[model samples]
Target: MSRLNHQWISQLPIKKITNVKPVSGGDINEAYQITTPDKKYFMKVQPNKTAKYFGHEINGLKALGKAIRAPKPLYNGQINGDAYLVLNWIDAGYQGSQSELGQLVAKMHSQTNDKFGFVDNHETGALNKTNNWDDNWSRFYVEQRLEPEIEACEKLGRWNKWRQQHMDNMISAFRKYYQNHEVVPSLCHGDLWSGNYMFDTEGHPLLIDPDAVYGDREYDLAMTTIFGGFNDEFYQAYQQTFPFDDGLQDRLQWYRFFYLCLHLILFGETYGGSVDSILGGF
Candidate 1:
């Protein structure tokens, strides 16, 4: 353990930790399971001067509240120039029923806001998510979500003439497709995907590492499909509670295109073909 971890652990309003074990499974930050004589805690650390999201993460988890079975924030602060966040460690459980996960997410999505965005900008795998308030969901998605990654990919030489032209055409027709159905400023997990959520020991769903925001609910649902693992029952349950209007199926790919662009920029060219294919459909 580093001195920073010791410093923060010592400061927590709990018994002194007797042991610390590195835990795998985090993609962006170092995760650890720290134990005392009778308790265990989960901690994530990010080096300072990189991206500090502990505060935003705490707010996001708290926003979800007990409505969703998410980790409870315990301690979060900077220690020795390292950003750290601590939470109650949840024990693994069997895969929760897809229907329950779906219903809980739908209930959480029912929480709405007047505008689309979050109070503070958050990091989605080193990428800054723009949360500037916007009353128009489509306009917000275009300017904040799509434009940033698209511009980054172009600057990184990931964009080609064909891709650029289709992207341009897609942007021109963005509002037309996005507005094909009714939408509200539904609270979203922002980065929802199979990996971000898990089942707790009680067979309940627990959402972790959220990039929460008030945006179109479709954006969240769209992410679940981009990466595999979500059962169809989850979608079915969500629709039963808050059904999408006609044309959502057509617009689903459009929403997914945003994430494809993000993956192209964040990971590599493996996602480039997918982005091109989605844009070509425009």
Candidate 2:
């Protein structure tokens, strides 16, 4: 709320400031669509009351900006000494009856990467995607992906201890069950949930506000499946395009545990049971 910042905001060439309303998006951040007479722009102002995590989000969005049907990142800047993101606003509609969810996601899965990992962005305050991008999914999953979370959980005194203390059992299941060969890097919208995806007025899908990265495609699909996004029609569509490996029942937790650990970190004990169940399965 500095005088200089207010003066600068007033300089934005807005035709008519129609409305600025709070749009409920996520628990951690603030979202709004600022409408003008001629056009609209999506606005995200992070809650200054908490430590900044949207830094990662901005980086993630930039990574996914190349997606065929996702929102384009317009500009990200600071106002009144806090962070905000302005993006291309779409006339997004929903389709609960549409079973094409899985099929469309499969199309998204077709989007690939150069190798694995992405070039870092400094202005957006993004972390470097530190992982071995080779074809080996398990080593990449355990060493580069899950290890960091497990260590952090231990540091935070969470119950990752059940698996961390007996790491061998988890590995045994992972090795014996899932048999994914070297998977090509499908640039993934790392956090794929119901909220991150939208359907435009035309029923064409658009994924927005991605926490994007490059990794095994299963990791992305696994999350959406767990959280109840698309229905069997979606899965059927995706299956027709590129069928998933059999025995998802055995290895689903192998991917899900990463997210479960994250929720445990972000939301605490409400997710503790899920973590326990995944670990207990092994």
Candidate 3:
């Protein structure tokens, strides 16, 4: 924690700052457990240049509303060169049954919008994801989600001739699999891997660190499978609430490939083979 953070916490409209201790599980921001005489809060701080990231979070949580249990945004501001967001501190809780979590997530995904994207952009790990308004899901995903990461991989010397060919082929397959059809612009948690959510003390799920967007709700379900841990019950419950499209199971790898691209850019060759494996399916 920086001294500037301490100063900023002291100046908040609360009782005097009592204690500030470091917390873990955040990918991009420095997190801390802040205590005041009146209450406790979680503070997530990143560079001032990434202030928009925190702002997106505040807006995303507001959009989530009461549909899901998540950290309530209490404050968003800057301290020195860093931007910080304060949220209500939730007590650590044990993981709940997959079925319960799945049904709950389905209820949250029921929220929809007239179009795809968000009011603003969001980040996945360190990379920014554009949520520019587009009514067409395929065009929005291909242009905003896939292309930027592909370009990044090329610039980073990670895209070879064979890889480029495979990516192009995959995109072609994507177009064939998806057309401007009946896909709804459902609210998505955006990044819902195993590690991104937790349960509260009573074993109810509480989402954290959302990169929320409005897109094919299947995009969110697809991510649940990518990182593992979610059991068949979760999928079964989600399906019970909302059934899958005809080819969603077959097209799962393509959407998972997007996250693999993000990992390849963030962590390098360790994730390279995974991307290759997904492309091989096309």
Best of the candidates, TM-score? 3
What lDDT does candidate 3 reach at residue 95? 61
TM-score for all models, in order of appearance: 0.92, 0.81, 0.93
lDDT of 3: 0.82
User: How well is each residue in 1-282 modelled by candidate 1, as lDDT tens digits?
Assistant: 565456666765568689878897557878888888888999888876332557788888998874667889998776667777889988988768898888888987999989989888875553667789998888888888887887787778888889878877888787886566556898788788888888987888878888889988878888888878788898898789878677777768877998888888987899988987898887
The digit string of per-residue lDDT tens for model 2 on 69-137 reads: 667766666655556667778886665434555666677778887566544321222222354445556
Native-to-model Cα distance after best TM-score fit, residue 31 in candidate 3, in Å: 1.0
Better of 2 and 3 by lDDT: 3
Off by over 4 Å in 1: 2-13, 49-52, 124-126, 178-181
Alpha-carbon shift of residue 107 in model 2 (angstroms): 1.3
What's the number of clashes in each of the models? 0, 2, 0
Residue 153 lDDT in candidate 3: 86
Q: For candidate 1, give the lDDT of residue 197.
A: 81
Mind giving the per-residue lDDT tens digits that candidate 3 earns over 1-282?
Answer: 555455666765556778888899556778888887888898888876444558888988888866877889987776666778889998887768788888878988998899999999865554668999998888898999999998888878888888888888998887876764577898889889888778888888767778899998878887888779789998899889877778788777778898888889988999999999988776
True-structure lDDT of candidate 2:
0.66
Off by over 4 Å in 3: 2-6, 48-51, 123-126
* lDDT score for residue 156 of model 3: 82
Q: Candidate 2, which segments miss by more than 4 Å at Cα?
A: 1-8, 11-18, 47-67, 121-135, 175-180
Q: After superposition, how far is residue 276 of candidate 2 from its true place, in Å?
A: 1.6
